[model samples]
Target chain A: MTDSKDTGEAGEVKKDHGVLYIGMDFGTSRTSVSASNGVRETVYSTVGYPKDIVSMKLLKKDVLFGKDAIERRLSLKLYRPLEKGVIKMGDDADAESKANLKAARDLIGEAIRIAKPRADELVYCVIGAPAKASIHNREAIIEAAREHVDSVMLCSEPFAVAYGLDWLEDVLVVDIGAGTTDLCRMHGTMPEETDQLMFDTAGDAVDAELAKQIQDTCPGAQFTVQMIKDIKERYGFVGEAAERVVVDLPVDGKPTPFDLTDQLKTACTVLIEPILEGLRRLIATFDPEFQAKLKGRVLLAGGGSMVKGLDTAVEKAMNERLGGGKVIRIEEPVYGGSNGALKIAHDMPEDFWEQLK
Target chain B: MAGFKETLKDAVRQMSFRTSLDKLKKKGVQNVNVLGVDRIIALIEAAVHRSLKSRMVGIDRDAVAESTKAEFLRLLRSNEDLQREKSQIEQARERAEEEIDLMRRELGEKRSLLRVKLEQDAMELVTRYSGENQAIAMKVAEICRSFAESGDASVSSVEERLMELVMDVVSGEREEAEVARKALQDREVGNLQRRIKKLNDTLVTTEQRLQQASTMKQFDRGISSIYREVQGLDGSDSHAGKKRELMVDLFKANLKLQKRGKGA
Candidate 1:
């Protein structure tokens, strides 16, 4: 048999090896990965550790992930380690920050593990980060990913979406993610800082607005942020109402159905003005010759884009506000960034990969 | 190139089976044509190159040859990794089997020892109780004899008194012996029962561990990737150049960030 050293460390021997390219979209609400091996998976960005010895024994696992973590959160020291589309390491360096960093690292490792890379292949990864992520936040992400991959790189999230769709020039992408909405304009080149815009008026904000509306209108209704977010994901829409969203909430430990159709519609409508504002800023600031092209090819992507009739609503808003425009939602909103990053990883020259290693 | 050839030879040898001359002769005629190892290796290389040249065009022959060699070496390395993992798992399974066997043997020995001790204690209790009963009977007979020999009352009255005394003494002695025997038996049996229970618990725990180890061994087959070799971007892709440029930009940014992190 060939010696065990054949699969040894990267530089130990000059054995010809295959490269496993992985593209990751790490978001506040979910982390998705697309690998060259054709594995695509998305996980909720939640990590949990058993609280004590008894819990650890009962769980039979040191850590729980995603939905399992959420379900068993009471028995766990749960951490949702990302906020506003970046690692939530608070300004001060403290125990909580360190714990969050660890959770982020673990979450990244779990994302890679789910890709199921072969041990004999070299692993190179590309991660799509928030456009406005600080250097420290980017560095933290790199450090976390480096533990699981041989080499890693980062790109802007909305730009990755645009790139994945092969729209290199005069295409505007609005990625409505859980924590933030990122608007990036592509114009035949890598976008500069001025080409992108970010704001927090996205999925989480809609959940908060919906929760507030419920509290104001539906007396004695009890719910959590997670429950409200789930409700929005299931029945959220703008423009014409498809159907009434009548959901049951516990009222004094009794199941009570509340008519939240108007509330949900109002909460979801909050995204339009801010998104149009972002669009106006990007389209108005672009070169006058390409403004029409940018407006006509506006692509809606991300989890928040999954809201029903959002594209038509955005199109309607664009007609009244900025002459006229077309809004097109991507075929796969959740996998857009990761798919683009995978394309980048594939097209990356071998020398660049080798140098990074 | 020499190392690659040697690795290929090793892989070939590993895949081939060994047999004795007697078995070979039984299967076929004995005479064999032997070739030098170097000659065999040269022939294989020439055959691969000729095959590639027949099917390929536009790409340089040398580049094709190099890539073929690289692909061959990569497959060989992957095979080697799988082999190593298989060997490790096999060893683990064997170790778990041995541990389970030892535990079973120990459990059997402990059970047999407990049974023997319990049987010996029962025998000793039976022997001691019979001996005490015989002594009590003799004492009762002696009191009756003394009462008959002494002249105190009428014969019939003396006989009735003797009988009553004998009955009372024997009845009291029998109750005392029964209680003592029961207490002794309960203490010894309780101690032995506790030991047997402890051994049974240990046996169950060891069996569970063995079961876990076996399950792990069964699950040791590593996950397989969809692509067997490196897959670069398809040449027909329209944005290959643009994507390449983006890749370069991304690399430069990450390099700077990583460098800064290291500096800090």
Candidate 2:
């Protein structure tokens, strides 16, 4: 289907459009659909609804996408497709599952559409999926892209992060995402299925634990998964001793200060063992030639990498196990996945798709 | 105590009869109705006429009294019989009323259930039936648009043809939609097309890989194995059909009518 839709319009960007590399760090908790179009920013992967068909019709749109979707969630159905890092089929009932996939597709589609490429633009994308996204999930994403753009490739999120840093050596890339913390070992080549490891415990788990702790301490405090996440992002840290910590809690429908130092530390520490275990396994997998190098060069990526004292905790645990190693944390959470995707789009020749197994 | 009171009453009535008979003997009265206009006169007349006449003209006075008394006693003996007959009439009336009430209740209940069931079914059918209807409608619309753009026919004929198409689609759509809606409301088909789609898409690559592995062997089996493997590409194509069927079922189950009041 072709249409003689005019170009050179006000809404259209008058740019070269070539060398315009687009990378989509499509994640479960939050998705940052960025392009080398101009600037980089991460938007939460969420969609919201309107009060009813009338409200949507009045607004002249069926649904709100991204941050707008979240802001107006009180009126609309809130959908997050990449639950646990992949689309889950609504078991026995599929309306919900279909809706999720459709919502995600629309969100991604909107982002790409907004980038506004020229007619002759070569639109290449390296969309991120969960490291352990079942084959079906990846295909669903690919199929969704059929109408969106020209060339699209699905890559693992952790691999994307690893690719962003160009750490193609014996580096253990641990991506602590919203739904799960994926650990992948890079041996200077495209990591195979054996090299990747996925576990369903990450930022979401900490938030859940923190919410439970808050509920237990303060009886009537209003809290939800999102609220707890906001709190965790603000005050999440891991350490032993600190000054007297006091945070507001709803005491009989009012905010009152109750020390949450012990609980916060506890919640932050919950993810320590899994990270350590992941590192140990990755280090052990190294064929004697790269074992020593792999020990010291452990890269922690994703938004969860920003947690205070996490590096120290991981380093300490590794020290206890391997006796010595260097643990480095990537600073740029926003462009990690995008940068990796862009690199893949650039490095892999156009004809390389023919060589895929 | 109640029985004793009844027996005493009977004895008093018998004594009065005896007194009346004596008074009748003293008087010249023969019948009750022919007696003079006095309380004793009425009683004496009744005893002489009713008791003595029947005795002299017929058989023994005691026997006549006993036999007449026996017949009268026999008539009053069955209290339950009167009650039973009255009860039978009442019971018949009650049964007729109850049957009418039950029939009315059943008719209303059945209508209520049918309406709910049909409405639910209709909604389900509308989604699928109307979905197909909508699909066909869209196709017709597309054809109309193409024809309009092409200038194949005059303006009036185009409009007329389009209207006819719309009418035909609506009627046919309604019938199928109703059937589909009923199927859905009746929960005959489980709408699961979307779910199957998600499953198929997500696992497409994995399934392909599995098939690839199954085909390839360690020793490189002959051309037969390769041909068999190539032929048995049990992946997206097979799942696509299943998904469509599931979708059709789902649409039927959750379809609601877009146009109208009741049946429409």
lDDT of 1 by residue, A58-108 (tens): 998889989999999999999999888988898798999999999999999
Candidate whose DockQ is highest: 1
lDDT of 2 by residue, B52-119 (tens): 77558755676554544443343333333444655655655555555545555555655566667667
Candidate 1 residue-wise lDDT, B1-264, digit = tens: 888889767755655577778888999868877676677778988998888888786667886687567756765664566567678767866776686677677767767877887788689879987997797778767766776688556778777876786788679879977987787667656776777677677768767777776676554322454555556667677777776676677778777887788789
The residue ranges of model 1 lying beyond 4 angstroms of the native Cα positions read: A1-17, B1-215, B218-235
| Each prediction's DockQ against the real complex | 0.18, 0.00
Displacement of residue B79 (Cα, Å) in model 1 is 19
How much of the true A–B contact set does each candidate keep? 0.40, 0.00
Q: How accurate locally, in lDDT, is each candidate?
A: 0.84, 0.65
